[model samples]
Each structure stands twice: as structure tokens, then as C-alpha cells.
Target: MSMAQRERQQLVEAMTAAGPEAPTLCGAWTVRDLAAHLVVRERRPDASPGIMLKPFAGYLDGVQTKTARKPFPELLEEVRTGPPWWSPLRPVDAIVNLTEMFVHHEDIRRGTPGWEPRELPAADENALWSFARRMGRRAYRRSPVTVVLATPDGKRAVVHSKPSGEVILTGKPSELLLHAFGRDEVRLETTGDPESVRAVLSLDRSV
Candidate 1:
């Protein structure tokens, strides 16, 4: 199966094991809420715009609240089966969801105590690195200092640029992906001026 598909399935499995009330890295969202958000994003495209658009947020929340009331098993089933064939998301599932699923999967795992980063295949790491590079700037745009993301093998991308100071973040591509997406608890090394490092690290609030 494709990496994105595999990640989705793994997330479903994790959610199933964690049950509905488990806490997630997504603010106050429980596992059920997260599942509802995932399903509504793909299944209810009419409501998806509200996810990132402030004006439509209440509508999106209403849909999510309704979806979250469904039997947890049904929510898991919908997530595992994915969006309908006619859904717009189906055509670009991998491109859009590779990072989304991976990040949310980690959200559930990391939210639980005693969790560790799972080793991913090289192909998956490469895909994540590419995605991070593509999305890094927008993800890190609010930072006060410039942000540079680097992989262990030396590949690097300038996520944000500023005049005063810069911070270099180094780790495996997957870990770097997690860091870029605001999972600051991931194991990573930082370098650059002490002030810059502090500024970058302090900007851990997720986008």
C-alpha cells in the first residue's frame, strides 16, 4: 500500500486502541474529536473551508460536534476506508494527507506517555522531507527569528528568513517534519546564536 494509506490505517488502529476519550496533541481534542475532524475534512468538503477560515469555523465545529457523536467504531471505519470516490480529496489524497495523517498519528501517540518516534522507511522519510520543505515557510511564518531546517544527511531548507538572528534545526527528516509542524517535543538538535535558538524554540505553538 502507499505510505499515506498505510499511515491512515495505522492512525485508525491507534485510535481504536486508544478508545474515544484519549487525549491528543490537538489542544483539547480527544481521539474522537480528531477522528471527526479527519472524516469531516474529507467527507464533508462543503464544511472543510471552515477548518482554516475563521468565519466558517462555527459551521465546521457544528459538523464536527455532530460527527463526534457517531459511534466511535463507525468513525474509525470511515477513516480507515477513506473519503468517497467522488470526493475531491481522493484525487490528491497522498499529496495532501501524507503529512496530515503522519502528524495526527503522532499526535495521538505522543499525547500518550512513554511514546517514542517510530522508525519509518527511507521512502517515507524522503516524502516527508519534501513535504516539509514545501510547507515549512507557512508553518514557521510567525516566528521572530529565521528558521533553517536540516536533515542528518545535510539536506536543508530555509523555512523562514529574518535579519536579526537564525536558528538551525537538525534531525532525521521525519523528526524534522514533526518539529516543523510544531511537535516541539520531538528529539532534535538546535544551533545558532543563543538568542535565536531561544526565539525559535519558544515559537513552538502549532500553526
Candidate 2:
């Protein structure tokens, strides 16, 4: 199966196991809320802009709240079924949902008790590393210092650069992906000039 498909199934399983009330790393969103958000993102194009733009946020919030009120089984089913035929996501599921599913899966896993990192296939690791490289630039685009993402396996990318100094974030591809998605519950090492390190840490790295 494709990476996106694999992660989607795993995300559905994780959500099912955790139940509706289970907490996630997405601020105050529970499993129910996260599932609703995913459903709306794929099925409700009108409110989907609210996910990224501020003016549409209220509409998105209202949609998500209403979706969340559905029976948990129904909501979970939508997430598992993938986007509808007419939805734009149907054609780009592999590209768009790959990171989306993986990060959210980790959100559920890390937010719950007794969690540990999973052993990912080499291909999946390479895909995640590419995602980190691409999204990391956007996350640190305005940083005052140069930023580098490095993995123990020697794969590295200079996502952001500045003349001031450098800050390097080192971790596995999966952990770096989590960090790029504004998640704090990741295993990573930050090493660089003191001021530069602090600056990068203080920045909001969420996607």
C-alpha cells in the first residue's frame, strides 16, 4: 500500500483504540475533535479554508463542532473511508495526506500514556525526511538565524539560512516530521549557538 494509505489505516486504528474522549497533542482536541477536523477537511471544501486563514476560522469552528456531535462511529468511519469522489483530496491523497496522517497518528500515540516510537520502513523514513525538508523551510522561513535539519543517518537539509548563526535540529526522520508539525512531543536534539538555539526553539514551528 502507499504511505498515505498505510498511515490512514493506522490512524483509524489508533483513533478507534483511544475512543472518543481520548486526548491528542492537538491542543485541547480529543480523538473525536481530531476525527471531525479530518472529515471536514476532506469533505467540506467551503470551511476548509478556515484551517489556514483567520477570517474563515469561525465558520470552520462551527462546522467542526457540528461534525464532532455526530456519533463517534460515524465520524471515525468518514476518516477511514478517505475523501469523497468529488473531493479534491481524492486525487492528491498520497501527496497531501501522507504527512497529515502520519503526524496525527503520532499526535494520538504521543498524547496517550505508555507510548513509544514505532520502527518505520526505510522507504517511509525517506519520504518523511523529504517532507521535513520541504515543510521545515516554511516553518522557519522568517527565522533570524540559519536552521539545519539533520538526521543521525547523515541526511541533512539547510531549510533556513541567515548570516547571524546556525541552529541544528537532529533526530530521526519521524521525530523531525513531528517537530515540523508544531508538535512538542518528539524526541530530538537541538545543538547550536546558544542564542540561535533559543531563537529557533521559541519560534512557532507548527504547519
Candidate 3:
């Protein structure tokens, strides 16, 4: 099976095991709310646009609220099976869901105390690195300090324009992905001027 598919299945399993009221890294969202968001993202494209667009934010919230009110088992089942074949998400499933599911899986796992990074396949690591390289700049565009993301083996991508000083963030690509997406709990090393390092480390905004 594809890595994305595996990640999705694992996320569904984790959410099911965590139960509905469990906390998630997503601010103020419980496990049930997170599951509903995923379901709406995949199965309800008509309501998904509001998720990222400010004007439609209320609509997205309403859709998620309605979906979250469903039986937890039924919501979990829909997320596990994924969007219907005719859904718009199918065409970009790999590009969209791979990282999305992986991150949210970690959100549930790592939000609790005692969580650790998973040992992902090498191929998945490379895939995530490639995707992060393409997406990192936009993710860090608003940073006050310039950001550079590097892998242990020397792959590197620079995000944001050069400033008076910059911070280099190095770690496994998956960890870097988490950091890029504003998960402050991710393990990463930063090197640069003290102020620049502090600025980079303090950032926790989503892309």
C-alpha cells in the first residue's frame, strides 16, 4: 500500500483508540473535532473551502460541528475509508493527504505526554523532504528571521528572504516538517545569532 494510505489508516486507528474527548495539538479541538475536520476535508469539498479562506470560516465551522455531532464510530469509519471515489480529493490524494494525515496523526499522538517520533520508511522520508522543500518557503514566509531547513545527510532548503542574520534548523525531514507546520514540540537544532535562533524557535504559526 502507498505511504499516504498507511498513514491515513494509522491516524484513524489512533483517533479511534484515543476516544472522542481526547485533546489534540490543534488548538481547542478534541479528537472528535479533529476527526470531523478530516472527514469534512475529504468528503465535503463544498464545505472545505471555508477551512482555509477567512470569509468561509464560519461555514467550515458549521459543517465541522454538524459532522462532529454524528456517532463517533460512524465518523471514524468514514475517515478510515477515505473520501468517496468521486470526491475531488482523489485527484490530489497523495499530494494533500500524505502530509496532512501524517501531521494530524502526530498531533493526536504527540499532544499527549510521552509521545515519540515514528520510524518511518526511508522512501517516505525522502518523499516528505521533497514535499517540504517545495512547500517550506510559503510556510515560513512571515517569519521575522530567515529560516534554513537541513537534513542530516546535507539536503537543505532555505525559506524566507535573507535578513541580517538567519537560523539553520536541522533534523530528520519528518521532524522538520512538523516544525515547519508550527508544532513547537518537534525536536530540532537551531544555529545562528542568539536573537535569530530565539525568533525562529518561538515561531508557531501555521503555513
Residue 161's lDDT in candidate 3: 67
RMSD of 3: 1.3
Say which candidate scores most in lDDT. Answer: 2
Task: Determine which window of 10 residues in candidate 1 has minimal summed lDDT.
Answer: 198-207
Which ranges in model 3 have alpha carbons more than 4 Å from their true place? none
How far does residue 155 in candidate 2 sit from its true spot (Å)?
A: 0.9
- Any residue pairs clashing in model 3, and if so which? none
The backbone clash count of each candidate, in order, is 0, 0, 0
TM-score, structure 2 vs. true: 0.97
Query: How many residue pairs clash in model 1?
Result: 0
Which tens-of-lDDT digit does each residue in 34-85 have in candidate 2?
A: 9999999999999999999999999999999999999999998999999999
lDDT of each: 0.88, 0.92, 0.86
**Residue ranges of candidate 2 with Cα displaced over 4 Å:** none
Model 3 residue 5 CA deviation in Å: 0.3
- Scored against the true structure, residue 72 in model 2 reaches a CA lDDT of 98
